[model samples]
Target: MSQVIGTVLSALGRLGMIGAIMAAFGVGLAGTIYLSLRSPEVEVPDIVSKDRFDGEATLRDSGLNVRIRASRYKADAKPGTILDQSPRAGEVVKVGQTIAVVLSREPKEGEAPAGRDEDADDAANAESSRGGSSDTNKNDNQNRNQRSKNVNRNTVNKNANKNTANQNAGNRNANTNRIANRNANVANRNNNQNTNNRNAVRNIANVNRRAPTPATTPANPAGNRP
Candidate 1:
């Protein structure tokens, strides 16, 4: 009976030791699972949005890195927006992996953009103003060309009139010279005729005076001698 009691005590001690070992193993396994499920904590570096950041340089200056991953087709989002992200916005995550983003493309044909209609109207008005100015300049140039033609014609007419006046003056001077020469010739001829007439008259008078009483004495001498 004493040997049986001692054997039973030894077996009970071994069973207790085994139960303690199993419990320790179970606790270690549970701790490992908890550690695997937990995420490493990291700060949300920065968030970039069009209205909030306003400038590309400003967004880049922040610690967060941006990468365009997708595109949206709106004219207003025309600026673009932050659509989806990994590690989700507020949750902690490892650094250096780029946060994917999206950008907006140019507007479509008929799509209207958000904001003032005045900008579009202003562009149209400016184009119209430029067209009007070009037309005015062309008309002004044409008028200037016509004025130049008129001035040239006037200059030609003035030159022609001057030439004609000079020619008429030369003709008048020639006529005067001919008249003076004819008058001079007539005076010389009249002077020569007057001189000839006077010489002939003087010769006739001298001939009459010099004709002597001819031979009257010859008849008287013949009667006396008989």
Candidate 2:
């Protein structure tokens, strides 16, 4: 039993350093492997000068998450631009770490220059409206002028027709008067001829009545002395 114990102790003493060295090597190898498999840190990109969407995309492409945590008004800066970042520009961070950012806010209501453009648009619309009304009025005036012109032409035509009718009536009256005067002159000539014939017949009858008794007495004495 003493010799067996001695042999066992000697064998253990010889194998212990080898086992320790192997264990140490194995641990070191495992640690190296673990380190190799771990993801490396990345530098945060400078996104302050970039648009928010562009910055966010750039961070995402670099294996980082992005968070828009707040916004501040900046009239000099472009709207929606990255203003500031936490874990600021050129910061080293692990993969999937979030880069918090503040963005510039857009101009608020009643403070935008777009209102001026709208006012210009309104002015343009008003001008167009006025122009349209003027055009309408002009058209109405043109139509009225045309109507007046037509009325004047119609009146002139009617007067011309009336004058033509009056002239024709005057001509007919002149013709009728001439024919009446001619008929009266013909009747007077016929009456004068008839009176002359009657006077001649009356004179012949008076001469016969004055000479009849003396003529009968002279013819009886030439035929018989008694």
Candidate 3:
């Protein structure tokens, strides 16, 4: 009986070791399956300032998806160039996670590519603004000149009217003075004629009164002498 118990105990020990080994292996397998099924973490690559197509390809190779967040004009960046990216470079992200990026495009229709000279674009824009300002100033100057000319013309017209009015007033004054002088001369001539007529009438009446008394006395004496 002792030998049989020893043998059974040894068998039991072997079974326990095998079961422990199997359990450990099963746990390891289960852990490996869970890791395989779940998405993995990945490092985000540097894509900023790179071409959009090239960066997209790089992101895809890194097991990431590209999400275009926005497209805008950047004076410093060329057309279709990547300007910025979310979850920046070297940051840990899950595999297949979307990397939102901002891209650069042409500022206007038919704009040339800004290859590397960002200052040149700024200069061109500044020059255009200056040109527009110059045009506005030129138009303003023209309008001012026109307004000044109109004012001068109006002043000249007013001066001409004033001179005409003064000349008319002078003419009227001269005519009035001439009429008064002519009336005074006519009145003096009429007064002198009236004085001469009164003197002649007085002389004729005196001569007749001085001769009539002597002639009547001579006729009465002649009748008495006969």
lDDT of each: 0.61, 0.78, 0.81
lDDT of candidate 1 over 103-197, digit per residue (tens)? 45566688665334543443344335334445677899999999999999999999999999999999999999999999999998998888888
Which segments of candidate 3 are over 4 A away from where they belong?
1-132, 206-212, 217-226
Candidate 3 local lDDT, 50-85, one digit each (tens): 999999999999999998866767777788898767
Q: Summarize candidate 2's per-residue lDDT along 89-152 as a digit string, tens digits.
A: 6767777778777677777766643334543443344335334445668999999999999999
lDDT score, candidate 1, position 183: 96
Query: How high a TM-score does candidate 1 get?
Result: 0.38
List candidate 2 stretches off by more than 4 Å.
1-131, 212-226
TM-score of each: 0.38, 0.39, 0.41
Q: How far off is residue 37 in model 3, in Å?
A: 70
Clash count for each candidate, listed in order shown: 0, 0, 0
Please report, as a residue range, the 10-residue window in candidate 3 with the lowest summed lDDT. 121-130
Question: What RMSD does each model have against the real structure?
Answer: 37.3, 36.7, 31.6
RMSD of model 3 against the true structure = 31.6
TM-score of 2: 0.39
Ranking by TM-score: 3, 2, 1
Could you arrange the candidates by lDDT from highest to lowest? 3, 2, 1
